[model samples]
Target: MTTDPQVVALPMGDLTFPADGAIFPGQTVVVVAYAVRHAGGVFLFDTGFREAAPGDDPELREYFQKYALRTRSLPDVLAAAGVDLGEITAVANCHLHFDHSGQNALFPGVPIYVQPAELAAVREPDYTLPEVYDFEGARFEQVAGDHEVAPGIRIFATPGHSPGHQSLVVETPDGPVLLAGQAVYTRGEWAGIPGALVGSSDTRPGADQAGYARSVARLKALNPRRVLFGHDRQGWPD
Candidate 1:
């Protein structure tokens, strides 16, 4: 793996949700966006949530408002980081949650990487908050298994949190850094402790609690040097 790639974490917003049942009171969970500078230009990991104005999707609007989440416009955030939205060559989402894909529209021409199963779920009528399925006008590359999106940056399917959920592993100078996304929400959760996740349903295979545990074990087996969660906290140390 080449050693020059740069990974930058952009703070999109915060959430006050719990990891499992434990009270993570005042947890400043940043929407946790990432950018990778590669020969192809820039690659975005996940698009953080964009706030909805009045009369938008009722369920979505209500969730954001109730949580008091402050979202940064995708274009503005990229500009502030010295990244031009149009220059971004590709985009990849960890999952198709509203909080993760809200800003996908910012890069209309970039191909967004997502799993085939996830795409189907996003289109299902049973899925609530249909806006989460919104792709924001970007092209998509539906991957079925583990593959490299760029040199030194690989994506692995880690289904359970969502059917098509995935995580990224970037070969960094320090070592391999796993962008675990929702696979694990915190260091403790990733450690196999119970009740470490939220917003999961029981219907899907491995969507419930045990699935998280299995995912945690799978990640641990990789022994990554560092693990960054979807929501902000400290990146886990291996």
Candidate 2:
């Protein structure tokens, strides 16, 4: 008997008092980390927040506190899922935000896939904030566009949340499951409202809102059975 690759969603933390029109309620924002199992080994989607001290940015610090970003390490979460850290083949991040890249250091030898533009944005002096990119001991694979990292997993460049932000599409038993990292905050945001995007910063650099629109359209066309948002409720077709 053989077992198919598994995609597991691990609970991390929650965000309260989200900005108006944000995905979650003042007390219902849940952050989840995902792990994918393939023949090669387990691949983690994003590493949740770390249990470290707050950084220098007041707004970020406040945001961390307001959202309750504290959570167990990636290794612990994997252990709970009956997975071993040593078995992890690679780490993939939609973008390099602190909450998403905190535990990247844990997987020292594993290759981390990130968008080239996203990496470049974090390197700029204006974006020199540490939270932008956590590259302590990571092996990076800078991607420009779409690429397949595993057997049935494909990543598409969805640069809206960040300059090089991307999303993962998995060919599941039911159909394609879009791990919509922060492209669209929630099912409600995507379906209910028009032009709802998570990251729209004017500081570092701006994303192609038009490109984002097209990407969303493309994902919609793919007709995924399930769409998992970054910090809100998942979407399922009726």
Q: How high is the CA lDDT of each candidate model?
A: 0.74, 0.71
- Write one digit per residue (lDDT tens) for candidate 2, span 103-197: 77777668899889989877765443565346466688887889899888878888765778888988877788888877766666667656443
lDDT for each residue of candidate 1 in 2-72, tens digit (9 for 90 to 100) = 44677777778776654342335455467788888776678788998877867577877776666667888
Whole-model alpha-carbon lDDT for candidate 2: 0.71
The number of residue pairs in model 2 that clash at the backbone is 1
- Give the candidate number with the greatest lDDT: 1
- Among all windows of ten consecutive residues in candidate 2, which has the lowest summed lDDT? 196-205
Report the CA-based lDDT of candidate 1 relative to the real structure: 0.74
Total backbone collisions, model 1: 1
